[model samples]
Target: MLPSITPFGGMNLRPRSSGSGGVEEARNALGQRLRELRRRAQLSGKQLAESLSWQPSKVSKIENGKQTPTDDDIEAWTRATDTEHETEALLASLHTLEVQHAEWQRVLKAGMLGHQLELSEQDAKTRLYRSFEPAVVPGLLQTAEFARALFSRAIMVHRVPNDVNDAVAKRMQRQEMLYRTDKAFHFVITEAALRYRLCAVDTMLGQLDRLVSLTSLRNMRLGVIGYETQYVVDPRHGFMIYNSDLVRVETYSAELNLRQSHEIGLYTSTFEKLAAVASYDAAARAVINRAIADLASAQPEDGE
Candidate 1:
């Protein structure tokens, strides 16, 4: 979410979702440390790049937290800076951030079902949960059938173990958190999400109905941004902001846990802007009704 920490080619990097900005802060600190080392060694960026057989800008990017340093890069940097004594301490900090990133492969090493349980645990702890979706229904408001289709798709795409049923069950269990009075939920979705057709017409209609049903809950705020509304901010990827502490964003290849305050605040502002242009209450129901109407029309004629 804070731009990607690494390039797209190889196994990647991630930020912290704990919301204390620990990962981001540490990255910035690492960059500062690297820069201090370079300055202390009286080496220019160009000189270091030439010495390491790397691009000059890479040295600058790593020193500014715009890019993450690989282990090899770290080693090379320390050696170039004549700070070999600091390598262990610096790598220790990097490892702290690495574990928090939760690379998808490592996370799914056990199974997808466990991932759902892990999120369920997070659900139990969150006091205020805000989900902003541009493409699909948020899990907290998904129907059992719709959720099944999603898990099944994940199995096919990610090639994770085929534990769709268990994953579905765990998701439904997480949905129970919505009924808690002490916690509050806010959902902002584009109308396009409802029409994405992730499930059959009937199943999606049921999902839409579920959306309408949840609207009556006092603590839940459901907002649908219809096409009719003018642009607020250019919509980006979907993200879940947990109590102003952390933001979780899923990409095609990985899940990003954004812990930086500025990044979290940016999403909060984006959600509010999207919410401002969204249709709520009765107007929101009308939008849902329209989607349901279209789905019904796509069904076969009754007489046939």
Candidate 2:
């Protein structure tokens, strides 16, 4: 839980736009269904675990959505509860949860280019895109060179199959939406994000320059929160809200796709809070300029 803090009410907190809810709710729904089945069979959690020769915690975790059940585990559970008929339904929910939280290795199994293309498809149809970053620039605003450095870092960190060139190309292609006048874009980044040099000093300098240039676009709203900006909400991780409906949050293991209205609202609230304190227009450009100058000053030993 986060420490309580007052919120800034200056920025709008309404949902941005539309998107599919992914797994978090599905996991909870599945857990409730399993608990219902257990109750219907007149079995206590301990009794069910004992009958299946599994630890009681396993039953509790599965019932409360703390853990995901295996196929065999589910089979044993249904058989023990005489609810085998529920197997198909349970499996379907599990399947949805698994796909929604697909591990990075599986997502990049076909290499990074595939995911880039998938993102491109989504961006092409999105009417409004809102993104918040605690560190690093959003992909939609990245320069090709900066993206190459970022993807290369991903290859090293995740040890995924490297198709860096193709992936970078596809990512660049996805940036075409910046020119589309029909869609609205709102981006909020923290001072830490501007300071984090994900790329070499030269590339970062260029990236900072790009940010400054992007702010000039009529359809784009870029906000930058300074290092000392007051925090109403902690920016735990970077997230993007697509069309005000779907929120996508990436962590070390999986990308969380949030579709529930309250979940999306929570993110929307955070985005607005961050935006309220963020510098915009000339102020935003000054932030980028300051970053560029700092990067340039450090370029002697950092350009790679």
**Per-candidate local distance difference test:** 0.77, 0.76
Instruction: Point out where model 1 deviates above 4 Å.
Output: 1-88, 302-304
Name the weakest run of 10 consecutive residues (lDDT summed) in model 2: 3-12
True-structure lDDT of candidate 1: 0.77
lDDT of 2 at 186: 95
Model 2 Cα lDDT, one tens digit per residue, 1-304:
2111101001112123322243655777888889998999999999998998889999999888788787888788889989899899888878778766756666777777887887787787789999887777888888888788767766776678889899888877777878888999999988777776455777878888888989999999999988777888776667788997677766555555676787888788878988888999999888878877887776675456
RMSD of each: 6.3, 6.5
What TM-score does each of the candidates earn?
0.74, 0.79
User: How many residue pairs clash per model?
Assistant: 1, 5
